[model samples]
Target: MPNHDQLPTDEERDMLRGSVRGFLGQHIAGARTVDAGRQTERQLWKQLANLGLTALGTDPGQGGLREVVIVQEELGRAGCGSPLLSAALLNLSGVVEQANDERVAAVLAGMHTGDHCIPLAFGEFDGDRSAGRPALRSDRLTGDIAFVEGAEGATHFAVFTAGPVLTIVDADAPGVMIEAATAMHLGGQSRVRFADAPTVRVPLNKDGVDNLVAIARLGYAARAYGAARRAFELAVAYAKERKQFGQAIGRFQAIQHKLANCHIDLQGVELTIGSAAKQYDAGARDWHWFAAAACVLAGDALRQVSLETHHTFGAIGYSEEHEAPRHFKRIHLDVLRHGGARPARDELADRFLGGTPDRLPEYDLGPAANEFRGEVRAWLLEHWSGERRAAHQQPPFAEREYDRAFALDLGRTGWIGLAWRKHFGGQERSAFEQLALMEEMERAEAPRAGAPVQAAMLQVYGTPEQRRKYLPEILNGKAIYGMGYSEPDSGSDLASLRTRAVRDGDHYVINGQKIWTTTYWGEYMLLAARTNPDSKPAHAGISMFIVPMDTPGITIQTSTTMYGGTFANVFYDNVKVPAANMVGDEGNGWKVLTGALATERGFIGGGIVLKVAHAFELLCTYLRGVETDGKPMRLDPIVRQKIGDLAARIESGRQMMLYCAKQVDSGETPPHDAAASKVYSGELMERFGEVALDILGLEATLTEGSPGAILRGRIEQNLRHSLMWVISIGTNEIQRSIIAQRGLGLPR
Candidate 1:
């Protein structure tokens, strides 16, 4: 039923984007100047029809929602307004539902040629048509329709009314009055009043109207994304050229971080919109849900990007002559078209809170990956479900996150090294399969397995003997590793660690104190210490080693974490590790350490977000049966909105993870992308925890084993634990700096 193969390739989409962009570039001088009156708008609509864009919504062979998205985005990028949303998408969708009716068929045919301009007046400002629906008695329409776009020169009005019927009424028909309403960013909005106006009824159902609105919302979101992206580009260009204090403003970390944040926000908006379009094209059952989620996220993220873009540009950006203002207007106005994000959020809340509770949509990660996901799901069902999972989950939250027996069982299946290379004793599976494995593991709430970072470092930089001894140990669950990069004072600024490892005859005598050593109980530590302390760059003096935890001088002082788990302040006093255990050449530890860190951050990004998703799922499940003050919790408007917001953000994080995995599959070690993923996902976990508590109230703060605790007190524990994700694996602030420097090419 879902023909993903029919979807456009990247090259095809690129070509389409180029063509649309080039066309817009030629016609529209600027966004603010695009509203040249009704006649000019009509002329542009005809041009779009000639280019086959007007037919895209009606003819599957011409193109589909994806093509529409490209056109809309280009329109927004150029800061030009078009009737694509109104005439092409909304009205055309309604007409197609009643194409067998001669009047509707004629209207649809005229629309393809850009000869008809029938904007649908189906809803109020808040997207509720039912509230003030026109009386549709005796085949006549009566009442006022508000917030109709492109109504200035429309050939007819497709009015949806109280009987849930669609009627085509002539703009100048008896008792019909069209009056200019308040201006929007794009202009050409009006109110239409009909006092028993004569009309032709086109048979259509509420489903048809819902579909029409969904299409319009998606189109508007694309436009918002395009506008936000253009604004960000303008800010970046200005930052590169705007000098301050004797250097480019972009060189400043403040500017860099601001622009980097805009970049991340744009990524979320773009990815969500793309996924929604693809789902719509595939005829997926949950396509509407995807559409709503896209709108909600785009409305929030793009709006923020637009605002931050101006913030980056400073005073000059506020000028109407500058490009930023137009895009800002476009993003704000376009996103709020179908009652903005609120209505979309309400739609999502209805689905999530009203029913048996549906799971998040599963993305199509390709055939091999799809099949592999199924296999992983089945395997998880068999190996880690019911009583065993219950028993594993009974411990304090942090302690339950990993299990040796489970890790050993999973390691025996060879899945722990799924994405490692072949020569290094791995199956060398695709990254998507690896993602599938991680996703399924998180979905099943299974314990983590193996030392992936240590295994990766050994595969790349370890000596031959080291690899032989250590690789299998990590792969077969025979060993685990503690990271020894941070000291009491050197956490985020890891290169500044005071750890020292002086080379002796055949061993490295290490002396350092590492704090927050999460795996201090493991067999070995992947340690980073300064070897050439006098080296000019400071970081170049570092070296990496594998130190056995059982070394005579090693002392572990464990401290309890706020999340009820323990980490150690490990003191390595005259500990002797064989020089043969060194991961890479001495004084090259920065590269080796960063390489391992990159891998760790990539999965950490994925792992943290997946954990939030699992927790969100649990929260949703709990809310479905909850009641307060005599009403269902799910029925509470505040509860519905919060859950909807969480669902959309979680989806955005999921897309970001998939994007990072895609980069890895393409042979790219995307450190910046990984950083972006890490930053967004880590922060999202924090936000989700807060929102869970807000919705669940005080009971959510209860601890494990407490009387009448909610979700075994996991919600509050997660709220506390979320702080670790943002702090561990490098702080979010550090990740933002990486994104600025590496992702956006901002000056350090």
Candidate 2:
């Protein structure tokens, strides 16, 4: 169970998911059974046992917690009222590895055949999973345990105490009574009062306790993930079918934006759970915190998604007859059952902020990439001083000399284009290594490399001449690039750009006006212009050229952005470019443009996530020392909650970026993947800025050199900068369109 790499292959996992889904659909995909309590799907239980799910964690040869996660998710989706989690996972899986013990062996063997109905009673009054502490006395167990899952159907109970000790007790033993308890989900819980119930102690070490808690948390998260997904599916279907004002409600931006946020939330939860499961399966010590993080993150996401989905369904959703209400109630039950999101988040914060100095989560980018991170981190430690960070704190839209110096130093070290060919002055590392480099640079608050667009595109689609002419200059920090794709009226509709490139004797004459060209101080511009006005599709006629910025008849007029960065309006009136400067085919600029965009989105997406992480760290540090109401700001419950929210979001964005990077390295075009990351990251930046300002209030507006300004007033700068991300690199609206069309395969 502790080796994720040894789990079933993707095809195998999918097959397992499909089989489980099919089974649940047949048996559990209807209205809930009206049974009040202690009811069991005896036949369905036998079928699950037949499917080998009951003994999944008994041996590696059978399966592990990964398989159990899949099964539980499917069960949740089907609204199955089964005790699989309590009996199979919590009890059987917990002791299966110690099968040599007579009791453990008997339980595991009988549980597989559905003959042993054992429920776990690990919590006391208030049912907080983390609140119980019990001690054995005179060969008897005395405690009032609450929220014992599946207790009404149990023949025996496995009770855990804070000594982290385990004890087994027969349900019929004297002085034990079970009271039927109401639950939010399909099954019922029971409050068990045991005064001097006969018990037998079971051995459990501290590590074993950690594993049990971690596995249980992961199980709940998986279940929540499935429930949230089902709710989302229902919402999406309803949005498409339900009409309002003579149109499907899904067509409205209000609904679309809400669903989009839900999509983002669930997707992030999916990745976080996957990461946590893998870490747990690998038996990594940090799995303890990661499991808790997963619980907190999933619970929060499920809560929002459940609310939105129910709202989407309107009146019908609120009725008990509808299925959505069941899922919504289940979401509440699942989350609160495991000490809820609040306590789970507090635990995560303690692990993060209270650990030893330098305690941080590992990137898990593998050995070579980690080595690269180490090298880059070491370099930054030596060079990125407090003064340098201060000097580089200018608006992202502004050109600062300190950024150039830092880039130059990195160039000299052969770090620029580290994943490119060594012959082209790159070290030929993996895409992940390059991402690691970018992540650290952003985390360090150092200047980012300017205009890697041309370099990145050239590595994939550039001609030999193009690579030789521009790549060396780019790697040496001698060439900066500005994009000349967006025209005044074209913007997101770049295929309809009016910029025309006409053939002349041995040259192409360019005529166009490009506005909002970022980093316009570059030495060169990748200008896209119409080469064939007669082509059937307008985009098919577009062509790209590498035009020198200082060419005759080219004028650059700088405009200041609200974020304090500078862009330019570049007018190319009859500017001539050598015919050889054309990139790819004369009328294939759309292909080149799109290819370049996928990579650019990755950089933009990844950079923003790390930037938020850096900003949050600063905000937390400030809160820790600053006073609110004569106490440290960190002591405020509201402030601590905000910090937790920010941390979860930052981690999600980080994982999304890693996924995008991995997609690129795997040779997939995955525009939808990049768009998802881009949209989420940009919007997350806006949220971070808003919350940081809320916490700091008027003090947050202080700029550089102000006495007691936080992070040199970068918080104010970030607020100004946040909106630009949503507008630039194709507006988030455009990205959502891409996601709907490409990722979800919805029609345009």
Candidate 3:
């Protein structure tokens, strides 16, 4: 297994996730079906937002989009109100030229200035065949828009029209009517009508006809990410609380398998959305087709997740008071609001020459992929050592000495750079072999925290001198690196970083800040800084640097998160470095950063997450040992059901991890593998935490070390940590955006 000094590929993130188990056990409320409008319980949202989510779409000059995305999923898990996500997406829209009118710009800008309500009005799918035009009209918008979610509190609506006539209308416009609609979702909706509301006019094909639709599709996908995340939590929570035939239902095979299916669907949809978001953010032309497909996939995904979630709860899920009904209501209402399922799909087919018949070539995942898997597994077994096994027993966020030693062991065996080029201390193994190794590691529940992804990326794109300096450190384990791409205001937008590095003769003076630097204590950090402040086209003037953690004037201030890890605010106040320290050429930072995640953004715990999965499995074994009234907890169907579901999710998460491995083994980057893996794995971790807490009942609130606590408080820990999984990395919303843009090729 890989060690903590390594970072897992996006596909392998779930491995080290056990850190959250303790939190979930302690903080996540016990699982008795959550009440409707429990939305108020989302104290987690306020806690995280202050952690600085509003700045995600802004630049280093403002904040970051990555953390915003990460925070987005946590909000989803909590099922809270949000204007941050929409603002981030809308900001991206403006950047890519998708926002056509003045109204759109104001709407987006308003979000950053304390505006908490921004709703979008794309026509909802009624699951109908009526050819009738939308009864809603713009004299000005004289009739009701059939279905809209979150509209009850909207200040403005970004309305999508058929022709070149999009607009933003005030919710309280003159002659406007807002009737609370009978939506099936747990979140409510409304039918908005205008007798003669004044609407701000915008272009339909301002950029391209397909562009607006793609943008609209992307928005839905984002919302779906929010919805699906909640639904998964709902089902998982229910599985643990409801018992049947003398055991927890969660332990039952039938319920577990059903949740597994939902897990898979959730992963797929999340992947679709992530692909789309990436395409839009990167300004990939000809991405409309991809965006449409992603929308369809995302749309369908929420529906299935919502439906399965309800099914898992049976009759209890049906009660209006149950959270399951709320999730279903959101799914059904949102499903139709944008384009139903087919508009996005049909739009996708129209873009493809053969109507999406030959859309994406099938990734070879059969014999060869499996064979590659076997080879890696065999190799890992052969290389298994005494210290490595011992290291596995330590928690993922354990003391650094243990992680560093374990990482050293992996480096010694040459597994750390098994796929690296020999010239630079790597084996220069084939891409397939690299992927094969990852597959084996993930399935084996191997540690992956400290892999040299940051270093290797620098090597691949850095100047020769830069490579000479850091490549050895990466290989020898003297300096494991962490990514500094994210900052308070600069998440997904690579070009907007404001960390500035200036030249002063022989040295480059770095002055600025980088936040969300994951391994705040790692030996070295790969920081992106602005070398050319006025470089045209936004992304053209950046440069990469290998900055030491203890560099003078460079302060790494740590911020604690509810998830238990401390991300740092790395401040550089004229920190001086030799000009030679710059990675690649000065002003070539964009090129270097572009492929930083070409392999993957990384597993949630990077190298250490899989350990959590193993720990969760251990928790499950212990859960089976629990009992309340003179009977083993395993005897209760619902308890069994919840545990069974967790087991299955672990399996599915592993499979998704493998699918990414297969893609890598096939010699190409798995486009949506990370998104697919991250969403499911994150949800899986969350569900496990929630279920464990629920099965514990009132006793669940007791802390792990508290007197008479059940499962040693493992349930509460998992419950709290699950929320972290939702927000970390690219956050599920950002992942969905990537899917919609990259996989589906939708508009901005």
Q: Model 2, range 99-189, lDDT digits (tens) per residue?
A: 4568766765666887666766554322374434455686688877766666666667777765655677788889789877666644465
Q: Would you estimate the TM-scores of all the predictions? A: 0.94, 0.90, 0.49
In order, what lDDT does every prediction score?
A: 0.83, 0.76, 0.57
For residues 1-748, could you state the per-residue lDDT of candidate 3 as single tens digits?
A: 1121232233322321222223333444433222223143233323333444443445533322223334444444444434345445444444324555566666655555545445554442222333112333543665456545455656676555556455567766777666664544333345667666777766544454345445555654555566577777666766776778977676665665566556658765565555544444444554564465555665656787787777777887767655555555555654564455555554433332221222231123456555766766776676553566545644433232235654665667665766677887777665445545554575454555454567657667777777777777677655677778876788866678888888999899988878877676877777888989999987888988887878888787787755445678888898988887787888887877766665554333222235345555555555555566887665565664454344334433544554565565566654455665666677667766676667667887676547986555556655676776666566666665554445433333
The candidate scoring highest on lDDT is 1
Query: Candidate 2: lDDT of 308?
Result: 91
Q: Report, for all candidates in order, the number of backbone clashes.
A: 1, 2, 123
Tens digit of per-residue lDDT, candidate 1, span 1-748: 1245665677887888998899888988864555356787678778887887777755554567888888889988998766676665543354665568787788767877888877776643238443246778798888888766667667788777655677888877899887775544445556788899988876666776778778788888998899888888878888888999999999998898898888888898889898888887888888888888889998889988888888888899878888888888778888887677888999888877877777777878889999999998999999999999999987766677678998899888888888878777789998888888888988887877799888989888988898889898888877889899888789988778899999899999999899998889889999999988899798999999999889999988999999788899999899999999888999999999999999988868888888998898888888899889988999998998998898899888988998988888888868889998899998999999899889987888989999989988889888888899999988888888898888887777
List the candidates ranked by TM-score, beginning with the highest. Answer: 1, 2, 3
Q: Which stretches of candidate 3 lie over 4 Å from their true place?
A: 1-402, 428-449, 602-613, 698-715
Task: Rank by lDDT, highest first.
Answer: 1, 2, 3
In angstroms, give how far residue 89 of model 3 lies from its true place. 49
The 10 consecutive residues of candidate 3 with the worst lDDT sum are 353-362
